[model samples]
Target chain A: MIKTKKIHKEIETLITGAGTILISSHVDPDGDSLGSQLALRRYLVSLGKKVWIVNHGSIPSKYMFLPDIDRIVRIDNFKSEDRFDLAIILECPDPGRTGDVKHLIGANMPMINIDHHPDNSGYGKIAHLDSGASAVAEMLTEYFLEVGYKIDDPAATQLYTAIITDTGRFRFSSTTRKTMEVAGRLIELGADPRYISDNIYYSFSESTMRLIGKVFSKFELFDNGKICLMALDNDMMRLNDFNSADTEGMAEYTLFGRGVIVGGLLKEMGEGSTKISLRSRNSINVGEVAHRYGGGGHNNAAGFQIDLPLKAAQEKILKDLREIVNGTV
Target chain B: MIKTKKIHKEIETLITGAGTILISSHVDPDGDSLGSQLALRRYLVSLGKKVWIVNHGSIPSKYMFLPDIDRIVRIDNFKSEDRFDLAIILECPDPGRTGDVKHLIGANMPMINIDHHPDNSGYGKIAHLDSGASAVAEMLTEYFLEVGYKIDDPAATQLYTAIITDTGRFRFSSTTRKTMEVAGRLIELGADPRYISDNIYYSFSESTMRLIGKVFSKFELFDNGKICLMALDNDMMRLNDFNSADTEGMAEYTLFGRGVIVGGLLKEMGEGSTKISLRSRNSINVGEVAHRYGGGGHNNAAGFQIDLPLKAAQEKILKDLREIVNGTV
Candidate 1:
């Protein structure tokens, strides 16, 4: 509570006299990053602050249903002449996470770095890096409530999406009572939970379901049913006309099997490479495993790309995973 | 709020002098029914009252992890000499919904019908049926708070499962701020959301995932992609070593498609009959449609069995569904 109050004070001090504001989230922005950015922008704009949302990456077609999503300018569309009194970096752990947009933040301009990553390296004039928060939007919602800002339906919808997606529909371990309380309040404020969930979860193309079927069939159980591994080979990818987004959350399927500790999905990235996504149900740290392979993420979910054939990649990755599980047990 | 208070007072008055209690939920109880029943039974026992939980059907194997599940006696195993000062029929629409246990309610035994079914027939002497509630557990949680009952970790776990399962992890339309607030309190009381969710959703056998793979293959879109119908024939059932529980909630798979308004699953019941389960997204009235086919259920979910071949049943049901969709559109 004291820390929350301190962050609120810091946010107030930073935004009090600011005029025009520039905002951007991490590259390959998810619902949490994009939704938080848009929601924060709306709140600031309502305070008569001129806000320019220049995201480093484009929004997914699936999330285009969010209100005013079209208003966010992509990095390639950002104008050099766009001036701002302040910049707000959202859901980005470090400057590099912002990709090309780091060039837009001038030395003299003050920046407020807001993030929920546990390992966030605070890199702004003011930082509200709360690792306890389920999503960056959750922190912003708290800030908004404390600062007496009214969250309209549009802002509520975006923030709600951020929380919902980040919390994996409130199933992730990070979902606290506060998370559900915020979600409930958001729903009461006209953010339809059913509508948002349908758009995010159910509106997949038939081809995506077909791909899901194919991926599901290839699932293999190992390590006394503690690990489940599935691969989308080059042939299947070609057959499905696979896009990067198609395989999103596919690895999490492994954790669905009873007693499965780790679930891994290795997607053929072509050119003798495979992108490995891992999801865990318990204390098994897939993030550390991913870090060893030049990748990092949350304890429960992580990913890395291996420059090896699918079979070879699976073998090496499974060996490392087995060792990790064995050590932990 | 007033209604909630009234029900609270009535419950206090009813349970004040009551000693031994008999409790039972509806037949084929899902997580909501079983969880709610178990939580209530725990609370009652904590008050130094003797409690016997007799359900029409046995508890599902997946829910065996719930504390004291072994205490619940199946209706078939219920002894005739058992007597109770009060009876609590949970999650049952009417007396008939209790299946074979209807005979257990003697003329002098006062009953409390706790339910959330929209079409619940108020039959109990003291009906605490709040259709607005997401589940009976949600209502019971409020009652426990109102009456000053200490919710233990085991009880919290049970109640939490009840809410999560009923609300579809807070995605359903009935979920409110109050629901989330209650959920938050339950978690704070030691209801591990991750543990409960994994058990309820992800602890399915490998055969279940294989069945899901098969279901995905059988999806057929019709009514201009607004309706999706999937089926498991007698052959498929036999091949998979079918159980009555295997096809449970399988019809809900249709609601996952992009434009699907109604999703139906047809299961071959053998002996020239097919059972149909219907799930709807948004405002499609599946219950009313099921009523036309001599079945009854909620507005969004309903089921009925047809005395016809699988192909004939599918054709007939599809035609009826197409007309309903056309009329609605």
Candidate 2:
């Protein structure tokens, strides 16, 4: 968000003058995405630079711990007089994978992709990708450190949120030795992991609870405990004022189920786009299925949005999951 | 909870020779206290020795993630055959400070008091209390390091929990450079912060959720925004079937009240003995008040138990809180 004065100069030269920076992320902004946005925004503000954290849409409610989080502007309403100097899309890949803002595909903004996803297509003017990093939040810590910015407590807090949230509190395989070092440094800078993880990851709204109950009630398991599936249609979502992001951990929770090798989420995104998220425990490949849909990720996790009806998409996912789970694919 | 075999050998010899290690703490059995106990228990078991981790009565449920958590023998249930080679109390001070287990107090076991409180009574064989240490957890890390025992992943995990939880995820004043170093060393040795914090801290149950709802619904604000209180009665708790530990942050949540100086929790512990917990935000010192009830902790955060009916305990605590908030005592 805050491209430092020197980085700003490079961006300016890249723009041939003053220009805009587009900010967007995964469909539902979790702690990592929002934390990354807030960190950059605060840094940019501190440097007296104009910056707007435009979204594909809104972030989840639990991350209200990020200071001044309410100020995030939506991508649709960002009234920019000039083209984006360097569009910075984080957490998510490119326009095709940008969910609702996928409409922004080929919108003519010079793109800068900064992400930790290994499957990135290098679809940016200047890309900085490190799949090795636990969280893009962790990446920002190194970025700030490299930029030699005197990041204080608030920046540390926001950045720490990014790392902790994205790395699943460092539970994911993405958590490497460097991740621990960065996280340790952040804690020393006053990240307060307990407060963030406690107040954000663990707590949920009553509405979220009801939605969780509804989803769990409808859970469908298969493949002799290898694959688990949960689906929610548009009607179910609307009744609870649920957005795509509120269904964040639904699929993953099933991974904790006894002997479940893979867990999958099939959410009806309405208008034929059904987003499917898949996770594996001990290497039942889901990325292959995701790649077939023009998406790819890690061996343990992958996701793709399909332009198919809810039931049809659900059937397709279940079939694929069944085959993979049974080793018959 | 696994102590190094080397430290285990040393402690076994100490126990055999010294015949007692005074097991006491500041007040409550937080992550630090329990982690230390659990890890030490595994070590003692390896040494083929029986160790007793006597608490006030019960440890809060938030920390039940440890093995043998329920096995923590309360001093009140002490049988005639129950004296130890050495009684090593980790987190409490005097016997009266031991919640419901106060009934187990006598002048029998020689004590080895290891703590970080400024007001320790020196009621032990070897008082290794350092007020500057961030936590007794941090102190134990130094102690473990001093005894020349290598902290493997599992051993490091216990120490890591002790340091992080007590320091409020490294946000509190107790966190020091050494704390981060200790964490770094632990990470280097394979201690996974995410696994421990998430497993130990984030894993909440259905009963906990229902209890949280009852808490928010029955909350109260008082002392001209200088205090917030929530009292859950037997019926409210019974209806929810929530454990006592599930309600830790309730009192501290009120510290966010802008004008509030302190916050308190007078939680009902069965029929008698109200579990009183307190937190101070800006200026008020709650430890002074807790001391009146034979409890002692930091100036900012401390707690005590009120051995009376829940309503009587609440009335007495409110009176005391008013005196502190109004500064008229």
Each model's TM-score for chain A is: 0.94, 0.80
Judged by lDDT, which candidate is best?
1
| Candidate 1: count of backbone clashes, pairs at least 3 residues apart or interchain | 0
The superposed Cα distance between candidate 2 and the true structure at residue B153, in angstroms, equals 3.5
Listed per prediction, chain B TM-scores read: 0.94, 0.78
Q: If scored against the real structure, what TM-score would every candidate get?
A: 0.96, 0.68
> Best candidate, DockQ-wise?
1
lDDT tens readout by residue for model 2, B86-148: 666666555445565544445665555666777677766656567777777666766566655
Ten consecutive residues with minimal summed lDDT in candidate 1 chain A? A244-253
- What lDDT would candidate 1 get against the real structure? 0.85
I-RMSD for candidate 1: 1.1
lDDT score, candidate 2:
0.67
Tens-place lDDT digits, model 2, residues A1-329: 35434553453355344344556776656677898878877765665556667676677666766887876876667666644455567777665666665545355667767788777777776667777778888777776786566778888888888886676655665766677678778877877755665565445554554555465556666866567777778887777777676576666655644456678888888678898888875456788889899766667677889999888998888888888877842
